[model samples]
Target: MPAPTDYLLTHGGHRVEVTYKNVKNLRLRVLLGGRVVVSVPLGVPEHELRRFLDENHAWILRAQQRMRMAAPPQEQLVDGGRVQLWGAWRELVVADGDRASAREVDGRIIVTGADEEARARGIDALYRRELMARIPALREVWEERVGRRAAGLRLRRMTSRWGSCNTRTAMITLNTALAKRDPAALEYVLVHELVHLHERGHGPRFVAWMDALIPDWRARRLAMRGTP
Candidate 1:
């Protein structure tokens, strides 16, 4: 099969990247930040591609709108900037110090370092430490409730997901960004992934299991995302 060709298509004031692949059907995806992508069979002519895009114009617009709405707001890591901590917005205070460190003082996040990069690193290290300290207890609680033990827990920064579980390996990976959200939200995610050890997909049975494990799981999800 030949490599996929990428080209730009603009219609009705919206631009989409069309990739022609060796496939039978056309696929459309609206990525985060409202980026549009379309995949179609290699032999699809430009006119047919245009017509297909026109037919799905409304869907493309709606998907882009939804993506924009679901996107998380960008955070500025600077002195006096507001950062989310445990579901509350707190002021960030950057200070110069011989050693870099981040801590909460007087209801504000204080990151002391020699430079901006150091301060940012210090804040990230602080979040990682917080997650390390908190995850064990949360995991233990949920493991006991679910009657399943996870192989291990790993933490990393993620933009698109809160957590993921490997049912086969019984390992749960959590988003380090959760340190910025409410601790309750972290617990919710832990419970969610732990439940995956028993049920793999988000179907009716999985939903029922979630309800039984965490009676208010839906509210926790909404609160975590700050959405309706």
Candidate 2:
């Protein structure tokens, strides 16, 4: 058996440490601070751990990059910068006019108001509008895939969880972060929440039903979780 510290790594922003124990599986996990650490059975060779990390190098880097980018300065909102809606780029334009509202015009989103401060408010308003525009399509897709009806769908600026469902009320609340992923992933999440109307928890039945509907849902779920 290799020494317990043989797999230690502090490269880049990720610090990984390894421990040997009596375990059935060689498990690798990224902690909340973006540190990836692994534990393996005592007899496993160090080469095996190295091979596993190398195989998953892409995922590790992608996770770290996402953690780094998620803390962007909110005050930097400006014109011509790309804001993602369903993982597609939407360019921003600031306009000074009588209309104190933001709108998506001519393939670009236009934020207009009498005061310069309205630009920031207008940008937030436009994000809400885009989300509203997507609700009907989301409901339709969910109905087809999950074979259930959602009484209502709401959007929120949630810090955790991409979406949630209230089976009692047949309502789903989706995190505004959905706007940051691809359209397909958004739809997948919508269907997922809608499915909760029929199945409450992510038990075996739910997994089977989800797999039945979206064959590549696991990949889409990983993509939304910021795994490249």
Candidate 3:
């Protein structure tokens, strides 16, 4: 296999990292931290790459802006720190103990462990457990409304998408991060993916079904995107 070539391209005072790879198409990605990356076929000339970047300058700028706006504020995950859960802010309480455990008490999340890392892991475990407990009930409700049943459900940490559906297998994989969001937002994602079971694309019929099934879906989506 050939190695990818990396270079930098500057246009109109903006710069983007360009990589030439063994691929058939040109792809542009604006990452979460406002970094711009363009991947092109190995044989593409520098002039062509520059032209492509030039043409898509506005799009790159808008994508970077949106990413910057949507990025969540970083958390230190220490005692007295706060985290968002179910669309609401909750205080984190850390206690000293040999065995790690996490639970919610009086609107605060209490984590006990030997150190910070243990406490963090304890909290993550709590998040996964809570998601597992909530998904079954939510799935049951949406299945009744959509008149379709999912064959399986899975959870994982995802950077870009909230959920995806495998229409072929009738499975839905949800982002574990949803546990930190509003329960209603999670429902919206569940419905959106389940709708994909009936209609694969976001066509008119799909939109119609969503409208009929979850009328306030657009609002929930906007909330997910952190839009006002």
Candidate 4:
């Protein structure tokens, strides 16, 4: 494999960093500060790349707008900082413990004996615990509603997406970040993936199913995005 080269793609005064890589798809990302980047397959032609830019111009602008309007990140985890649990902000209490353990008591998250890194892990453990306790019930209810059963579920910290469904494998992977959002947001993501088990893409049929079942899914989605 060769190192990827980067160049600028400019369409209608919008500029993006384009990198030719081994990917089969043209991937676009609006990073922090609204910087645009695109990963193009090595074989894609210059004209197609430019057209991609033009076609996605509106989406890029919206993404930039969202970035600009999104709220600043939460404060660092410390003795008197705050924590997000099930979409609600609660006080953080750092206690004394040799290892990482976190629990919610009296509507406050208390972490004992953690440094910077362990503090993060402890909070993640808390989120995973909450998700695990809640997912089984949600899956049972949604699988019946969607008429498809997921063979497995995995949890991971994702940078971009809340959840993904592997239709071929009948597996669903959810982001732990969802634990930080409203409980309804997590339900929306799970239901969205459950529907994908039968509906392959986010087309008309998918939208219809989503609308029919999770009527307020769009609203939940907008709220989760934090820029709507």
Candidate 5:
């Protein structure tokens, strides 16, 4: 592949990075952290690119809006430090143990382990376990509603995305951090990724699915950024 040429295009008061690549068609994606990038085939004129951006301005804005909503929880996951769990702020209590482990007891997140880092891992393990326990029921409901079934679901702690779908494999990966947010946010992310099984992009059809299934998805997405 040849080295791609890059340029900047300002639209709707947002600076978009346009890369002229060797691809056949133009593609646009709003990455995590709200950066917008457009990949166009070599030799596509700037005027056409601007026109494309104008045509898809609304989608770009919405994607950016969603990206901005994942403002990571502000609290530390240390002993005596506070943390948010399922959209509620809980007191973090840590104790020494042979290995790392955590659980919720009496409205508090209790971590048992050797050190602060271990306790943090215990907390993350708790998040993964929580999400793992909850997603099966959600996937059953959402797959039926969306009329698409994923081959499998996995969890990971991600900095940039809430969830993603692999159309070819029918597998979905969700951010474990979601277990710390409002339960509603998890449902929204599940539905969003599930819909991607059929709709490859967040274009009109994908929006239509979101509108028809969860009318308040936008509100739930925007609320993910708020601190408890």
Candidate 6:
């Protein structure tokens, strides 16, 4: 492990602390906040790091601007953090015991617990149910538009890609995180995955097909990656 380096960065009215991690291939990355951070190999010269930053200067600035512009919710969805569901904001209630179930009661989604762990699980379960219900409707819409049949659909909590398709099996796997974003993004992801049924790799033909179907596919793609 490398010792941490802290740097100050400003984004609109907020100040963020950035920490750099030294790993292989050594690259610069920024989290959601407008933080300037860089990582390099153990023996890389300072001059090389400067060159890398120069080459990526435009990207860094754009990322910072977008992060600053995207308004963050006043409250988080963590334990005791009031969360908005559907159209109303409600207190995140936690209950103890195994029987604690998450369901909408009087326009509020309730969980049972005292800390982050219990509240997170219940909140996740609630989102998972919503995703499950949406999948079938999404599949129907895309199937009609694409005129192709998929082998199946499965939902899983994935850390990497939003969704993936097995062309051979015709089955699609969607990320659980999609449940938190807008419904249109979910539709876009579904279409992207299902299009894999025809084109295994993303080539000119794939782009053409996607462009024909969703004119703003590129914008939608960028939005999914949390880019502006």
- Specify the highest-TM-score model's number: 4
The candidate scoring highest on lDDT is 4
Comparing candidate 3 with candidate 6, which one achieves the higher TM-score?
3
User: Which pairs clash (backbone N, Cα, C closer than 3 Å) in model 1?
Assistant: none
Query: Candidate 2, which segments miss by more than 4 Å at Cα?
Result: 1-75, 97-100, 113-120, 226-228
Tell me model 2's lDDT, rounded to 2 decimals: 0.72
Give per-residue lDDT, candidate 5, residue 41: 87
lDDT of 3 by residue, 153-215 (tens): 988777889999999999999887787888998899999999999999999999999999999
Return the TM-score for candidate 6, rounded to 2 decimals.
0.59
lDDT of 5 by residue, 103-161 (tens): 99988888887777877788899999888888889888989999999999888878888
CA displacement after TM-score superposition, residue 6 of candidate 6 (Å): 39
- Alpha carbon lDDT of each predicted model: 0.81, 0.72, 0.82, 0.86, 0.84, 0.69
How high is each candidate's TM-score?
Answer: 0.62, 0.58, 0.63, 0.66, 0.65, 0.59
Residue-wise C-alpha lDDT for candidate 4, range 1-228, written one tens digit per residue: 554479876776777788999898999999877889999998788888888888988998778756744546564588656778888776677998869888999888899754878888999999999999999999899999999999999999988889999999999999998888889998999999999997989999999999999999999998987511
Tens-digit lDDT track of model 1 for 1-228: 554488788876778898988789999888976788999898887788889889989998778656643555446567656566777676677777847789988877888878777777777788889889888777777899888889999887777899999989998988888988879889989988988888999999889989998899999898877421
lDDT of 3: 0.82
Q: Sorted on lDDT, highest at the top, how do the candidates line up?
A: 4, 5, 3, 1, 2, 6
